[model samples]
Target: METWGFEASNVAVAQVRIEQQLVEAATRAGLTNLRVTTDSEVETIGPTQWLGAEVQANLLWTPTFAFLDALAAWPEGFRVTGFQYEMQPLTPLQQEAGMTAPTGSVRIGVAFPVILPPTAAAPAAAGAGS
Candidate 1:
């Protein structure tokens, strides 16, 4: 096997796409007051180029089964590295608003391979000088 490890250049775009998809999934699952943030990075795994990011989101309540199902069906190249959730105590505002359910925070780590277009090797780089 050969190593095609390379730097990923489309990190920003990938992060935005991930955030959008997460938001959409939350909406579809009826998760309200959704707030999200993402931190993006790149990594090389053998012959693959990957973008790694952590998506942190705060919701009014815990995630539902529908959201988990949607995540399971995420598109190819989208890999779940980690997932965690924390239940937060209700704030004064929430209590005042008659909300009984505690707020929840979720963190999802993901890594997706970057599919790059193939390029023709230069003559000099292809052993022409040898």
Candidate 2:
């Protein structure tokens, strides 16, 4: 089985809405067997101001490679901003038992920064009724 983690950023208004969208997108892409867990409030550490409320999802599936490929092929607007994984080697005996030991499971962590159009920017004030 394959497992992964995902994250999204720069969200406006309700965060749950964005999470639903992502889950829908994944389901539409044939990732039917999905288990998602979310945490709305989170904390960070270290000198960098690298922390914010985050929603994390863990995906599990069979035929790991195919699942990863499908995720990579997500639409342009739905960019997969970040990813990570852990590697574990299997013993020879395990391989012989018809168990396809995972070379590694990729943890996909994405940061979707909602970029509004320039026109959406704040309007400048008229200087002294020019």
Candidate 3:
């Protein structure tokens, strides 16, 4: 069994919505059997929220091929700032046993830069301004 890993970053404000859409898109693109695991952290940068996340999905097909197809079919409104793929080889014992590994497993994670949004800056008093 081949495993595929996907990492998406710099998402939009509607992170959850977009994530769901992406999953649907993947399913429509012939990746039906999908298992999803997700984690997220929020951060604030000035007014805008800078959020980052990593999503890993194991495909039933070849890892590289599935990843490429998924990447190509990714919907708009979501920018994939970064991505990576790794091939995890099966153990010798498992190979000897002639057992096929499970496929279509997905893991999603998010890492935000700032947890809390910054409050409004305090105004300076007249004396302080002087």
Reference-based TM-score of each model: 0.57, 0.39, 0.39
Q: State the weakest 10-residue window (summed lDDT) of model 3.
A: 116-125
What TM-score, to 2 decimals, does candidate 2 have?
0.39
Better of 2 and 3 by lDDT: 3
Clashing pairs in 3: 37-108, 43-114
Please identify model 3 stretches exceeding 4 Å from their true place.
Answer: 1-13, 29-53, 59-78, 99-130
Worst 10 residues of 1 by lDDT: 1-10
All candidates: CA RMSD (Å):
8.0, 12.2, 11.5
lDDT of 2 by residue, 1-130 (tens): 0111223332232245445655665565444345443323221122111112222333334434454465466442233435565656667887888767555444544433333222321121122235
* Residues 34-128 of candidate 3: C-alpha lDDT, one tens digit per residue: 54333343333344343454556664455434544665654331234444434466778878888577433444343333222232111211224
**lDDT for residue 126 in candidate 2, whole number 0-100:** 29
Candidate number with the higher TM-score (1 or 2): 1
Error of 1 at 35 (Å): 3.6
